[model samples]
Target: MNSKVVEEIKIKGGRVLTLVEGDITERNVDGIVNPANSYLQHGGGVAGTIVRKGGRIIQEESDKIGFVQVGSSAITSSGILPCKAIIHTVGPRMGEGYEDEKLSKAINSCLELGLRKGFKSMSIPAISSGIFGFPKDRCAKILVNETISFLKNLENSSTGIKLVEFCILGKDTLQAFQYEFEKSKPQS
Candidate 1:
């Protein structure tokens, strides 16, 4: 619960994008994205943390939904967590043929799903930067760029998403995302 917003910026449609350093599980958003595998296994990494804090209902719901494809996402109840829902997204492995594109698509999938689900705010972590073996810096850049592009294109659109937060955990991971967020600022 020690999460803190490192920085924030406004995108199109007056939406807010934030770089946060803390645990996603404690975020008080409408939804929190889980960087899951193809099988929706809640064994380790972010997925495990979500399950550990959120509860077994999350995994049970995931089992019912079965497998989710890479670059795609599935939704489930947040169990006892603060969020209403958890968006489980599958990011491609490091050796995958098209890692960058797949990661971008994964982020898009999470955002699109959140929009459709009427999520006004959501928190996401570095999708493929953990055990999936993706480079943290590249993952941060792609996540920030793709999310900004998607939000910018939603001008005048019927989008309910007003806030998108990158709730990173580790010091190194947080620094990576922070760097990307700062670099994204427009020149004064």
Candidate 2:
């Protein structure tokens, strides 16, 4: 609960994109994106933390969904978590062919799913960057860029999402995302 707001930026349509150093399970957003395996098991890493804090109903709901393809996402109840919903996204592992594109698609899938679900705010982690072994810098860049692009495109469209947050746990990962976010700022 000691999460710090590392950075906040106003994107298109005045929507806010924030980077936070904390636990995603504790975020009080409309939705939280989980970096899940295809089976949707909340057994380890971020998934485990979510299941532990959110409760077993998350895995139960995911079991009902069965499987999600890499680069795709599925929605489920947030269980006991503060969020309204959990977006379980399957990101590609490093060394897989087309890792970059798959990671981008995974991010887009989470955002689009949240938008479709009429969520006004959502928090996401650095998908595939942990045990999946994707490079931190590349993951940060892809996630930030994709999120900014999605928000920009949503400006003219009807969407309930107004705030997107990158909730990172580790100090190094937070710094990487913060750097990417700052580098992505529009020059005046």
Candidate 3:
């Protein structure tokens, strides 16, 4: 769970968007978005780590909720974690038809849920970029662009979201996200 903010930028409406390298479970944002399966299993990957750090109650609550459709999201208590809630989102697996659109919807779903919950800050990971076999570069691009689109459209002046941190893991994933964010920066 070792963590640090590698880069940050002030987007439209003065929202502080950051690219963080570390475990999502350690972030102290208002909510942490988990890239989960449709059945909400927390047996491995980031989902497992979240349950391990946050507590089994996270999985128990997810089990209670049953299933979440792809490109959708469901909220659960953060358990022992610092965040107020855990937004579980289902991203598309590789080879799935319309993977790009589904991933976009999944990211958007997390943001919309976070907005509705009045979360001022949220930590999200590279959805479906792990065992699901999504190309990290593409996932990073989608994650960064979708978040920017949401913030610019809503404008933090009238929204509760003041910060959005991509709490990424692994060197490759971090690099990919960082590169995408760098590309998004406005020229001085």
lDDT of 1 at 52: 98
Q: What are the lDDT figures for the candidates, one per model?
A: 0.93, 0.92, 0.92
Best by lDDT: 1
Give the alpha carbon lDDT tens digit for every residue of 81-156 in model 2: 9999999999999897999999999999999999889999999999999999999999999999999988998887
Point out where model 2 deviates above 4 Å. none
lDDT value, residue 36 of candidate 2: 98
lDDT by residue (tens digit), candidate 1, 3-100: 88898978867888999888899988999999999999999999999999999999999999999999999999999999999999999999978999
The segments of candidate 1 whose C-alpha lies over 4 angstroms from its true place after superposition are none
Instruction: Give the CA lDDT, 0 to 100, for residue 30 in model 1.
Output: 99
Q: Which parts of model 3 are misplaced by more than 4 Å? A: none
- Compute each candidate's TM-score over C-alphas: 0.97, 0.97, 0.97
Residue 113 error, candidate 1, Å: 0.3
